[model samples]
Target: MEVKMIGISKSFGTNKVLEGVDFELRSGEIHALMGENGAGKSTLMNILTGLHKRDAGKIYIDGTEHYFKNAKEAEEFGVTFIHQEMNTFSNMTVLENMYLNRELKTKLGLLDNKKMAAEAKKIFNELHISLNLEAQVDTLSVGQQQMLEIAKSLMTNGKVLIMDEPTAALSETEIDNLFTIIRGLKNNGVAIVYISHRMEEIFALCDRITVMRDGISVSTHQISEVNVNQIVRDMVGRDIGDFYPEKTTPIGAIKFEVKNLTSTGLFENVSFSVREGEILGFSGLMGSGRTEIMRGIFGIDRYDSGEIRLNGEQITIRKPSDAIKKGIGFLTENRKDEGLILDFSLEDNIVLPSVDEFSKRGLLEQKTIDEFVALLLKRLVVKAENKDVPASSLSGGNQQKVVLAKWIGIGPQVLILDEPTRGVDVGAKREIYLLMNELAQRGVAILMISSDLPEVMSVSDRIIVVREGQLAGEVLKSEATQEKIMNLATGGN
Candidate 1:
């Protein structure tokens, strides 16, 4: 179950994604693929899995030259790819989604519900996953859906498993369980290709590492042979100094406050405040109603009873537009569906929030918009050919930058960032953090909801822990510790 790809080259029209990249994976070992956004890591994996045809390349599986016709073919041949983006039928039950297109049939060609349920249960049990088979996927939280995807991939019993940011949506406990399962698979001789921007995870879980940059594989080293700094330098081709920049902004009076916020079954009596020029971190286990609270505040969802105040003045935000008009911006965790319109050009997406500002006398001002977009793109260091490129054309990290750019265009007084650096690479993450510092210096209050504990601890001026839809505890950055926060989040103290 060894795979070797050499001299791989792929291009989409004038844009070349991968050029002469080489990667190798051995059986029973986890090989990591690390790269900055748009650095051709996903493109290489897509080429290997047959999602994209390589214009020129050599693929050898167990010393045999071969290429899969499509992803299905690759899966059937014992290569299963669990994409970063969860693939599930929202309307279908969890069990139905698990056995989709590969269901067992009776002698009379009837669907075997009993057999399917048993098989699914067996896999879920082995993986230490607790899920309601009868529940519709849409009703499940993002973390549950992510775990379901991993369980489904395990059911395939593939020889080579490709996991892309598999723990992005998982809680600490779930991530531990997943790591244990992955280790078990490795012991069973299953080769794994682990792709993630989280250096900690890579160093903790992988055996070997390959760094890619600008459409080529720069270096590959054993896990013990390289440090985080070395890997980052290889990926970004420069020393990006500190991982989290120091905060210099002075805190002011309360800029944004949520008082006695209550949603029917989501969150209850949640209250918090962010001072001007302050970055407040929201820490919680996945599905602990953090995102729900933000959505309620942003007017994407209704709260049964709540008070939102800005500058000590109570305000009514019944809709997203209303929130926007009140100088509030929201960067949702689910960026693909809510943050950016995928098919729209980068310029259009960046200017969406400030459309009226670029209009005069009921007429759109094209030059003003173009200038604003170009400036934001440059400021954000968005890696795209031009502002006219579709939002979908950029990589995940670049797409996130574009989302932030749009919020910046509006000059928001308060910004709500949910999982702001979820899938972003190290280099882009620093840039975003620096931008947050800059915004804070300009007196913008930011609420960052994140699952990455290290990130939250490093960037936040203050942190509030949420558990089971309530505010569990709050601590200043100087006084907070990971154990303390986790204890608060899990009701230990």
Candidate 2:
């Protein structure tokens, strides 16, 4: 089967997202769609999946023009979309959620649990994924939930499978497993559309590449014909050079310190300090309590015993408000669920924590609020047409920028960033690194928690390894290597 979209154009009101974009996929090939954030990648895919109406375009399958009314219609035509957002019924069991809308039934008109369970088990076995079928979807971790979403899409057995950042929330091990499954599907003649910001994944799995820029189809080439440099230049119009900036800012006196922070089962006796103008990284495996310690410091999760000291004075922080007022900012790992309120606008989210700053008693200074928002949006380079549009409407990278803007607006003494660049594009990641460098040079203390080893070693002034809910060890950046860090994290001394 082959799917081809020709001269596709779409616009939301006056904001043109995709204009005359062309995308094609053939059976047994993994076509990677590469672009910077807000570069019309999602809009084009939405049109192909029938979730959004294209202003002008022609979709042809097997060289035949066809029109789809909705996603179901597109799916029936062997076109299925696996969104970055996990789509599941949280209240239902995994099996029930897997078989939603297309449930198998018996002649007696009852739900066929036995058959569904077997089929679900078979799919899981094929994918090398394990999870309790009886457990409710809400009980699973984000990584497990993401696996379930991919498995559900596989159950469709569509000819054309569109994956949008399918590995965004997955661990390194899980990513390898997903690659195996994708390869198997490709061998079976399924046309796969893989979208991701990870450069390594693109070079590893994709056969052909299509790069989009500013609502236009920039170019499409065989993966063998292009290198990372060319693709990046097409996407953002310049060479990114080195992704990580040089940390030239000299470290000053300890600006923030957490002494013996303990959060019961989550983490314990986690002691760390961040110097002014320093980028300190916390490294650990996924479940190794790296994020928990930061949460403990920020007062999002209460520590059973600990003292947070800034400069020389101890402070009391019992909630997010307390932390915010005390000049501590946190950008959470789970951006969609925790960091940014999806329903709020970019401008609104940026100024959310400082609402009182613009409101005089019962009155709001609209001009003051607008000025603040405009400045941050320009400073952060949020890359959106209307600041009033819901944050949910922007791409993942742009959404992350908005979240960072929110924290920068707080003017914190110390900032804790958990998985700061998790789902953003490579260009956006570089931009964020430069921003972090700029912040550090300005004397703001930074504590970053990251699972990406290269990022941790390259960008941090110091690295702290966490293992089994404890502070394993700490190393200076000049002395830190991936092997040394991994050994420390896994208790190898």
C-alpha RMSD for every candidate: 1.1, 2.1
Q: Give the alpha carbon lDDT tens digit for every residue of 1-493 in model 2.
A: 8989999999888888988998888999999998988898878888888899999989998999977888998888788898877788889999989998989999999989899999999999988888899999976756678899999988887898989888866656678889999999999999999999877899999999999998998999899999999999998899988878777898899999988988889898878888999999988876688877888788777889988899879999989999899888999877888889999988889898888888887899999988889988887778887789999988888898999999989888899998888778878898899989888988899999887888889999999999989999999989999889989888899
Query: Which numbered prediction scores highest in TM-score against the true structure?
Result: 1
Q: List lDDT for all candidates, in order.
A: 0.92, 0.88
Report clashes for each candidate as comma-separated counts.
0, 0
Candidate with best lDDT:
1
lDDT of 1 at 82: 90
Backbone clashes in model 2, listed as residue pairs: none
Estimate, for each residue in 1-493, the C-alpha lDDT of model 1 and write its tens digit. 9999999999888988889999999999999998998998888988899999999989999999999999999999999999877789999999999999899999999999999999999988887887889999988877888899999899888999999888888788889999999999999999999989999889899999999999999999999989999999999899999999999899999999999999989999999999999999999998889999999999999999989999999999889999999999999987877899999999989998889998789999998898889999999889898899899988888999999999999999999999998788899999999999999999999999999999899999999999999999998999989999999999988
